[model samples]
Target: MPSQPTLAFNRDHIHPGDRLCVAISGGADSVALLLAIHAANTAPRESLGVGLSAAHVHHGIRPDTESDADLAFVEDLCIQFDIPLHIHRADIPARASQARETLEEAARTVRYDFFRSLIASGHADTILTAHTLDDQAETVLLKLLRGAWTEGLAAIHPIIHINTPNQRPGKILRPLLQTRRTEIEAYLHALNQPWRDDSTNADTTYTRNRVRHELLPQLRTFNPSIDQTLANLAELAREEESRWQAELSRVLPQLLLPGKPVRGGGRSVSTAPGHSSLSIEIERLRPLDPALRRRILRAAARQLGSRLSFDETSRLLALCGFLTLPTVAARTGASLHLANGLRADRSPREIRLYREKQSANPE
Candidate 1:
């Protein structure tokens, strides 16, 4: 028998009176999480001092017979454990068509919307999803392949806070973030439990499927512990990202100024329809390290509801006249029109970023 997987819930995150909901999809990872949580709740010596609930979302992408069977299995499992279960049936294909999104994107949006509804309706205080170490590894590799930055390499986060329409705060927690998929399956097998396999997982057309099925196995030939190694990289990146965020918070206020610089005793605001504008003094920006400079430029764009890609950030930095060295003279009267109706302008003394009022584009 395989050694049972331990539930490593953070004591700081879970409270005695908290209502925790486990998102189960009849897959090995999710089924193992629900089982572990339920067992902890029932064990006299190991009780977590919290209520347990289960939720399942049936994405209507697979055949009805297959999807319906998964739902049935989840329902029976919940009933056997005497746990409250919530079920959501989503027409994912129709949703994808209507929203002009891929099936994967639509399914994720629908699933999160349902989870948020549960929290807003006071059904659960926290939602737990079983994202394992393997998932983190896959995410990190995908980000690397896409030329992602440090934040992207951070991959999956363990905790996410959601603000609901009803003014209540909800949390999404991943308790199994450090556990491996092999351990999860072993735990289920030890319990004589069977999980439904999603047939779509075999489709290599999806980038993640190819990574999981082909790339990871080949990588294992070179490094047997590649999964764990990648997961550790993500953890390290997350720590670095947290540190950078703190530094940005401390330094941004002094460097960033609001609106255009006053020229000849009159403010020269852009005629472009924009909600707000932000400026940073070139004198303050030029002396900083290149890393800090890029971060500040990205931060300023973010304040205007725009995200700067790596190339975009480099372009903005070049516009500020820091091509190869800080000693380069600052440029004046240069402006860049960016995606999502955001624009950046360089003046003699400052660089300004603003969002032109256009059709709302969510980040």
Candidate 2:
């Protein structure tokens, strides 16, 4: 389509002879991806000894129309192209209720869960998905509408990390991120291949769908280059996020102070609270840059298995600054109780984030 190398994805994420598992949905983007990868494997290039595999996830909703030969088309494509295919059916409604997630989120979770399992079972080295530049544009806009921070702006990473607890962590590569949807459709059209058109894509009730159909068109009137501009902004944020994450990883551990020791026991368990406690000396933490300080605190909260939202992270940062001074603590200890069983306590010595603690205003 574009060129051999550009057609597939960034080669840095997948090595020569590495087996790649492609997530396909019988849609144009995914069909184009599989076709592109197939083309790459057929051609002669340096570091081109790559293996191809496909997976189709059936999100068990709207079964009335979903049963229309989508899987059969994928299976036949894989058969014709000689690529291995894995088909999975998920109970999205039940899964969503159990996880307190919406049906869309649940479908995503199930799909990725299966993707990670493939890596764990030694089936593939990397996961490739058909996320395009337009998807990146939509993601950036969606995050912006939700009052996102800098990290949120870093949408749709080309090489994304996959952390499925208890399974081997893997990475997902998006080869078509630089390509537009129109290019993908054209690529498939050039091959005389037909793809399943999911009716759900046109449903404007979904926020992403609305953003794609309504907001993007309106925004295009102001700046015809809005998609490219948004994509560029995302790329810039991704570079900055990489640097910031590396720095945060280094600084967060150093600021942590071990919790006080146990009173008595045969073998005393060292009460050193790691990043999970969200605890640090007020004197030790107060001197750092506000940005760095907040990152550390956020890291601690994440360690405890709860990600602090942008609003929550902002609220907790106020405590980091205010609690370092005596006037904030005053008499009996002051604390702020937050969601996810998090409690930020100030004892005039250190600021602590712990679970199952009631806040005392101390006013």
TM-score of each candidate structure, all chains considered together: 0.92, 0.85
Per-residue lDDT tens digits for candidate 2, residues 284-331, read 876787777777877777776766886666666666564344333333
Model 2 residue-pair collision total:
1
lDDT of 1 at 66: 97
CA lDDT of each candidate?
0.88, 0.78
Candidate 1 per-residue C-alpha lDDT over 234-311 given as tens digits, one digit per residue, 9 for 90 to 100: 999999999999999999999888777564764555656657888888889878999999999988888888888987
Candidate 2 at residue 89, lDDT?
A: 84
The TM-score measured for candidate 2 stands at 0.85
Global Cα RMSD, each model: 3.5, 5.2
Find the candidate with the highest lDDT and give its number: 1
Model 2 CA RMSD to the hidden true structure, in angstroms: 5.2
Off by over 4 Å in 1: 1-12, 264-273, 324-330, 358-363
Q: In model 2, where is the ten-residue run with the lowest total lDDT?
A: 265-274
